[model samples]
Target chain A: MTDLSGKRILVVEDEFLVALEAASMLAEVGATVVGPAYHPAPALQFAKTEALDAAVLDINLGTGTSESIADTLKSRGIPFIFATGYGQLAGVDPDAVVIDKPYSQAQIVAALRHVLA
Target chain B: MAVVPQKDETRALLGLTDRLYRAQGLDDVYAAALDAIAVMLDCARASILLFDDQGAMGFVAWRNLSDEYRSQVSGHSPWQRGETQAEPIFVRDVRDTGEPDWLKAALAREGIVALGFVPLMANGVVVGKFMTYFGDPHDFSAHHRELAVAIARQVGFSLERHAAEKARSEAVRDLKESGDRFRLMSEDAPIMIWIADSQGKCLHLNRMLRNFWGVPDEVGDFDFTSTLHDDDRAAVGAAMAAALRDRQSVTVKGRYRRSDGAWRVLETTARPNFSASGAFMGMIGVNVDITEREEADAHKQLLINELNHRVKNTLAVVQSVARQTFRRDGTGDLEVEAFQGRLAALAQAHNLLAAEAWQSASLEEVARRSLNGDADVRIAIRGPRVELRPKQAVTTAMALHELYTNAVKHGALRSSEGRVELSWLTAEAPRGSLVVRWLERSPQPILPPVRRGFGSTMIEQALGADLNAEVEMDFQRSGLVCTIVAQLADTVRQ
Candidate 1:
């Protein structure tokens, strides 16, 4: 029920249905959605070029890891939470929040809100 | 009255008696006896004969006697066989005696004009006789006959002592030789071998075992448990003690540190050894190294664990996809059908992954498998062989399934006249890239949908996110065309 009015958030996830559901949930909270980049390169491109208030990143993007994208968001001071099926993320920043896969919409949105705060 | 003995004769008699007692072997006894006979009495020749099991007398020692004379006259004795109390036979002259003609001729040939035979006694039994021959016929003195009797008694006792001594020494030599042979064989053996006494004291260790333990050859009374790994020491020691107490053979496996400080797995088998009288003597053992086999077993266990983890993760992903598909507004049988199709696509990808040991799958193969329900004539797939890692293959299969579903519902595969061309090629880019194109040609005009559905979102967003690809889907009047370009080298895991 937290107000995400006028907040711009970028979502990066590999699964199409999962990413779409996550994007729709953010839109319902009144947050404008950016590219739900399926691959790391596009996600990195979005992280560098787009105007983002926050980001939701799937740790594994079928092609490789989203570590480069995570790095970009950190450097830009954009708050983000990691979404993954893995128990541990190798070479990832320890301070970053993680949301396990098959997560509920509430879980994703709340984790993002907490990271953004 | 007895004549007083001369000083030289008395000294000679004393020296001969000392030599008879000091004789070490049968040969020494024979030599000492011959010297005594020559020194004590006047004789042309002397011989000693002993009776064998068959009661036949054979000359064992002789002095200055021809082989022909000894052979011809050896059996001619004054007393019959087993005559233990017979008195000496004195032949004043061989020609005058009532002996056989051949015996007289043989004695005459050797110049024995007179001969005296004195019986030898051992343990109060007459065992043999000694003969003294004089060149000229003479009357026998009672003193000379008494001296001959004393010489035979000394010689007879010495022969018995020498025989016993020889048998004892031979037995000792045989035992030593057998022990030496056992040591030599153990030293050359490739496997570790050891022997321990009845009290569990180490008696011997082979060369291989010594080198493995970094111990010297002469090291004695070692406890093998000292070298055992800490975890296995107590148990192994207890098993060894139990086996020893039971006097039974035992086989055990344990870890022991080698000379280089590496712990190696060893299987040891010890068997109890016993004496001829069935007394427990000791144990002999052999050790074999099995470290490599143990390592291989551990590695297989680790792989099984990893496989279990992967299977659980895959199931979670499937669950997520199902929940998302059913959560959509106005979702019904059609949505269920789509979900089932996606699941089938995921299963096909897993099959390909399994076939390749979960390493990589061929891109062309995944495309063909995803579009399986469509007739062969409706879909044309053209692509060079390109292998994708497991993750890439699964994501690509889901994307292809969505594309096929759309084609069947609203695009090319809706009508018999429709056809879809799927082709992919690798391009040499900075990171090396692959470009896959799905071109649909339908007889009916294709129209762009007013709202983006799950299929379009998957073909564009999910495909790009998973593959790090640039996706473009065009809804043209003629057909629905989709183009995907992804970095090939960056996506594959080494």
Candidate 2:
């Protein structure tokens, strides 16, 4: 149905609105949404348990730990995208797509397809 | 007519010549001259016209002439006379024949005839001429014309001298009035105003100076040098000598002993009064009693010294209090820092009070300085500048320090994401007293402590006891706001 159709997607963001928007965008592209984590704890848990999925990660969580989540996602076969308010993420995976905040639904889908491919 | 009254005319001419010399001024000269000529020749009306530097004769001084005749003479200038072919001779032809002028008609209504012009000569200058109109055309003899010219010469010189004397009188009168006003003003002045000769002896002193030194008239000569302080008399003497020698103003500060034997400091600035020839007449000086101002400065210095002593002692006491309070218990629980904080607040209050010389301190200045350690411009303001007295300053300084320390330890400014909004404003009406509000707003939620801490108690006591003002501190859902009502009457007293 779309460029990201039948693709598994993971979303990570500290703000609830951002996390919900990423999940919706993945669903719009006919991709199955995995996790939309509001904190680094849930995001890290999702990165370790979920298999073969593309992930979106928020670089700054209120708890100040997002690097560990990015590192965990890199160990898995999951391709990821980083959503950060501040510039340049620390310890991000080499293959991950870095998208700044306030992204459109189209951009999320396009980035998911690129990361999955 | 066979030249009747020749002897009567000779006597009249001699009388007219004397009247010319006795003329009071220009207007008098013109009137007497015209009157004398008219009476001698037996004419109806007479007028004299004097030309100015512009050779224009607009001035007409007349005698026995009606309003109509004077107006006709004034309306015409000397240029009109020059344009006419009529000479300095008599005009016996065409009397009132040319125009139906109102002047001619008015004169005819009164029955008048021939007019004659006699040139009034002074220093060979054609200054003006005289004219006489008779009711009937009559022949004028040579003696009658010669008398008119003689009257004109005497009147001209007398008029010039009269004008000069009149100007001199006005100048003298004005100078006398101005000098009298100056003397009256000096006597009424609040300061001791005096005039002294080169030897520092009194020539004149105003009423204030006499009252200030308590010198009585029975004391005979009011000696200005006697009132000078013993240690300063020689210096003042030497300075006056120097001023007279150099012809410059002299200034000195010395004590002048009052009649009650009380010595008062006087700052005297004297300038040598001189005449037009640069001769030194006397010395005029204004004496100001600066004793009160000097005393106030000395008091302020003492306050600063006391403040220094207290600060050093408080620091030493605080160090000992810290050691005692901290090590009182075997187990160290970081408990003594709480006590250390309160002592530091008191010390800081003293520091600000000393900085202002105990006159008054700026409320905003104390607030900003107290909060310096806590935030860097994180606080927003909402009030104009307010001045606080010494007592209010010390109390407010202590309270501000407490607020700053508390905010650093617990409030919004502690966190990087947090912000503070401070609003201080006085009430609309500033009559007998004023209401001041200090409001603090932050995003972080804070509730008023169940029991008031040392900071809150001190803030209440400081405002209430020291400032004699009411204080209200509230920790609301939005933020903490403290409002105070202080009477400006007590704070701004000097």
For residues B1-494, write the lDDT of model 1, one tens digit per residue. Answer: 23436675677677877887786667777777888787777664788888888887889899998888888876666655567586787777778778778777777777889888888776566778888888888677878878887777778677667766777789879877986788889997999998888887778889999899888988676677788888997777777877868879888889998988989999989998877798888888999998998889767644643453355346446655665557665568566556656665776676566556566888888888789656367898898778898888988999999889888888878898999999988876646588899999999898887788887777788778778889988888768889999876665532
CAPRI class assigned to model 1: incorrect
Name every residue pair that clashes in candidate 1.
Answer: A38-B464, A38-B465, A38-B466, A39-B464, A39-B465, A39-B468
Candidate 1: C-alpha RMSD to true structure equals 20.3
DockQ of 2: 0.01
CAPRI-style docking class of model 2 based on DockQ: incorrect
- Residue-level lDDT of model 2, residues B1-494, one tens digit each, is 24438687677667766766676667666767766766676665777787766676754676666675566546443334334332355656325457357646666765666767666554445556777777776677776666655665666565556756888899889977986677679987988888777565776677777888887633356786677878998888788778788889888888888878899988888989777898777888889889898889878766675554445344534544444445655536344555545555555555555656656777766676556544346765455677777777777777776666666566655665555655555544454265656555557786665766877876778777866678887777655677777666545532
Top candidate when judged by lDDT against the true structure: 1
Using TM-score, give the best candidate's number.
2
Per-residue error (Å), model 2, residue B441: 4.3
Chain A, candidate 1, TM-score of 0.90
Off by over 4 Å in 1: A1-117, B1-17, B38-45, B49-60, B64-68, B71-97, B113-129, B135-150, B183-190, B195-211, B214-255, B264-284, B288-494
lDDT agreement with native, every candidate = 0.78, 0.66
